[model samples]
Target: MRSLDSAREVCERFHPGLVKALGELTFAEREAPGSPVIDLFREHGGVGLLVPTEHGGHGADPVQAVRVMRAIGSMSPSLAAAATMHHFTAATLYALAPTEGRLTGAQIDVLKSVVPDRKIMASGWAEGRTEQNILMPAVTAVAAPGGYTLSGTKKPCSLSKSMDYLTASIAVPGPTGEPELAMAIIPADSPGISVHPFWGNDVLAAAESDEVRLENVFVPEDLIIRTTEEDPERMEALQLAGFVWFELLISSGYAGAAAALVEKVLQRRRGSATDQIQLVVKVESAFAVLEGAARAVLDGVDGEEAVAAALVARFAAQQAIAESTATALELLGGLDFITSSDSARLASGVRPLAFHPPSRASVAEALIAYCAGDALVLA
Candidate 1:
């Protein structure tokens, strides 16, 4: 509980009253559709948690970000899950710094409102959980007068209901007149933007992971961010940076849910001394792995190396969640299961981490090859 408490303190420091606000709501209320968690998140300035100080954000470092994510995760898994999408999308804004000359004026204008207006961003990239490759573009861009028209669907898109902007991955025309991967920032209220039900589970229903369909959605040219011909690797690097944040923050959220169950077990002293110690060891060790990866990024690690670190943390946290939660439920036994639904809800909230993008199965081979002195290429 010391680590969780400390992590929560960090969250409190960054976004005052956020944890308390989330705590005020019942788990059932927070997990239900039409949940007020997103509203609370916006009011608490959580939409800008990852934005930099120059951009009117908290400017939390990698360590602080993960800590806040864990604290938030402990309270509302759905909020943490949905917030991960928004936070990671905001994290990309750092790479698009004005000095980098990578952002268009229109893109900068929309991003400028993110922190001040508490606008939520939904990720349209990383749709590869259903596709064969995780990095494939999600939409097709047809050249139009001003910019382009896009048509596609991102299923299970988090923050679908409340998002103010959608950061989409699309295949734009290249110099060879072929499809090249690029990112487009589309306004949520665009002519062809719509949302429909897709998420059927109640585990993290508050996340609003549903289908976001775009049909002939017109986007201005200035809102599109593309890789320079001089540096063709720019787009891949951008995606990799996003992947690192995604892996660390999302995994921490699930870890927080599992930690909540562990806290319950520790409080009631239901398990034996040895059992409690093992629970702490397993959970803490998993968190240490996650934090270690975060620290690595802070220590100037980037590119494939940073992504590899994040994946290690994510997979390690996944295994720990599986083992620790099962142990917790067993110690809780039949009575707790019947008496309180919070324990089950908290435990179930963490199970979906295994299903996020860049899954263990998809990247195992690439990681192995990278360890053998090969470039890490995620297919």
Candidate 2:
């Protein structure tokens, strides 16, 4: 498994310009509601980090992607969170395309456009009032002559204003007239697609996570992605792949933020040697667990095992980050906490890791069942 230090070094080496830009942006500036850091990131091909090399992207594997996310997370959690949406949207599409032979042409075109056009994609799949799974959207898609007219809203959609394309989940009628889950890649400028401001909070302000409302927006038939009635297994596999990638990458980003706190604490050198050592150990251990999970994915492990590994790693990293951040704050003292805006902002930033999908409370039962040898279905 790649060590955390080596991963950080690799990221810095490969994307020095990005790392330098991130370093130059103060926490306050990066966290500002309409910060331009994301645009800077996009200019440096941050949007195409996961695109295949043949398509003019770096084509990073799971482990390398984890490292890059961690590196970004250490510098800016807002960017990391926003970028996660982009990377995973691409990843999910890429991972599922071959299974159903969908999006092979679209993926190529999209990936090729990402670097040259500086195009960024956003994920518009969150429906606040729905009980459906993340992969199963609540948006209604009515069949049209050459496409589907979609109507619904995805709140807290990351990269709301900057996205050139949006990959969203929608519900379309099956052969039996029942709603079936499907995804569509719609251009941001499509008629009837509106962007609304919904994220009013200070936390993650720069993420541009607002509401994307689609009102009878027509998506061409070629952009629709769904499994055939005879290929239900492909859909299941796609779901699993998406879940694993999201969990792993998202957790790595937060871990980077937590790692940053640890680095800050070390630089000050206010804490006793023992305290610092303890913090380092905790942070390193957490990263190691994440590394193991990343390696498992890179080694071709998939399905239930991959899901379980990602969950376990994410929970472990969250605990470590929480504990390490709390300890760092205590050691840094009240004077620094009261005066250092960056320190205070980072402290607040680390708290959001708990709110990501598949909350511990909701998954506790399933986790136990899995440990007892039962199938690990998150839903």
Candidate 3:
């Protein structure tokens, strides 16, 4: 019932407590079996930012979603990852569903009844379209009596074990070589759906990434949201808009995490010196960039401005997380090298950021686009 700002305020108010809980629980098992963080999510109604009001969501804007996520990320990246999957799925639904919305009268009733009781939702995408990539499974949709059956495997689905809904991307074959991309929303217990565990129990231990296999999973047509190919100009605009919010959610969260790491370095350094003050300065500068970038995201200066801002935030946050984590190791001296402390975990996490989407190369392109006149008019 509250406004978007108010919803954000509530999340902000709970930030310190939730973050403290996260810090205490960090060394626990990666997924930790029964995570209190998951409980927190359920209690807060599963980060209601993406859910529509009609569907029991708070209906907050994407910017507010970014703020909420950043606050959560500062405390726990794993939990932040888990929470983001839900919003990402929700956003996908928003984009794909009809103008009247995807959830039907019956479906909305079921969702409202079930979502409050469910803490998570998983999303599956990334098919191995090209050969030599064992992961990308071809998308196939066969006509069934009641509806269509979806078949394929989507990789890197976060929160697979705990989520209630699995939204997957399938390449429904049509006349064209490139099958139409459609989002299929399947319940966690749907028949013929199999989830294969993927990512190792290392940095992503707490957050399980799985490969979702749909073997003739029957889904009513009403549930499918077909992706429409639009004019190049319009598609570009939509793509940019999509990136703006998604990037804000991701970049801001990483910024908060970086800030936390910096704080930890300071805390440990002042008490007992190992790493030099210059190390602190190095990380602090990264933090400064993140802060500046966050402000830019908040300000909504321009399309190009927003893209550049988000890119800067991404670069700064990753740098800060990497360096501060390294400093944590040096500050701890021999402890980090042993692979037993948070430093080891963070070191592993930083390594993957190199491969994470919106890579540095992409960020560079965004910057170049802004530098050129291309920034004018998202279209």
**Per-residue lDDT tens digits of candidate 3, residues 27-108?**
4443343456766666656545676777566766555566677556656666766676677556545442334543466445
Q: Residue by residue across 97-143, what tens digits does model 1's lDDT show?
A: 74557777787888788999889999888553553454678888899
Off by over 4 Å in 2: 1-5, 97-100, 104-108, 127-132
Q: Give lDDT tens digits, candidate 2, residues 72-187.
A: 88878889889888888877776653443555576557656876787888887652333445666757788999889988888788899889999887777777888777778889
lDDT of each: 0.88, 0.80, 0.57
Candidate 3 to native Cα RMSD, angstroms = 6.0
**Comparing candidate 1 with candidate 3, which one achieves the higher TM-score?**
1
- Lowest lDDT sum, 10 consecutive residues, model 3, at 127-136
Residue pairs that clash (backbone atoms under 3 angstroms), model 2: none
Positional deviation of 200 in candidate 3, in angstroms?
1.9
Instruction: Evaluate residue 312 in candidate 3 and report its C-alpha lDDT on the 0 to 100 scale.
Output: 66
The TM-scores, one per candidate, come to 0.97, 0.93, 0.73
Weakest 10 consecutive residues of candidate 1 by summed lDDT: 126-135
Q: Pick the winner on TM-score between candidates 2 and 3.
A: 2
Ranking by TM-score: 1, 2, 3
